[model samples]
Target: MSTLTERIDIQVKSRHELDEQLEAAVRELQEAALHVRARGILITRRLPGRYTAELSDHVPFGMTRELLR
Candidate 1:
């Protein structure tokens, strides 16, 4: 079990773009196929044209954290 706390912010014009980038980021992070058990993607938008995407720090193994709407 491992924990990933680092966050990456994405700036896009629309939610669709954000979603696309967010999934890409997640895929990029897990691209190595290191068996990161707690692989989770958290998406948050508290500012305009900016979205936060990060691997959830407390996600249970074999499950992903729910997106923060």
Candidate 2:
């Protein structure tokens, strides 16, 4: 009976430790996800401006060609 009780206690402690580690891992994953989402948002916000700049740079060339013709 004593040995059974001792085994049960050890199992409980191990399970508790595993639960804590799992919680910590979940928190870390959430933080990483937030950082990734923020970076994605930043990139998305900049895309339109970058595309407009590229288009604007080509406009002068087109205008110059029209003038030459």
Best by lDDT: 1
- Clash tally for model 2: 0
Clashes of 1: 0
Which lDDT values do the candidates have, in the order given? Answer: 0.62, 0.25
Which candidate has the highest TM-score of all? 1
lDDT of 1: 0.62
lDDT tens digits by residue: candidate 1, 1-69: 765435778899988987798788667545422356555556677577777766665654334354545
Which pairs clash in the backbone of model 2? none
Off by over 4 Å in 1: 1-5, 32-39, 66-69
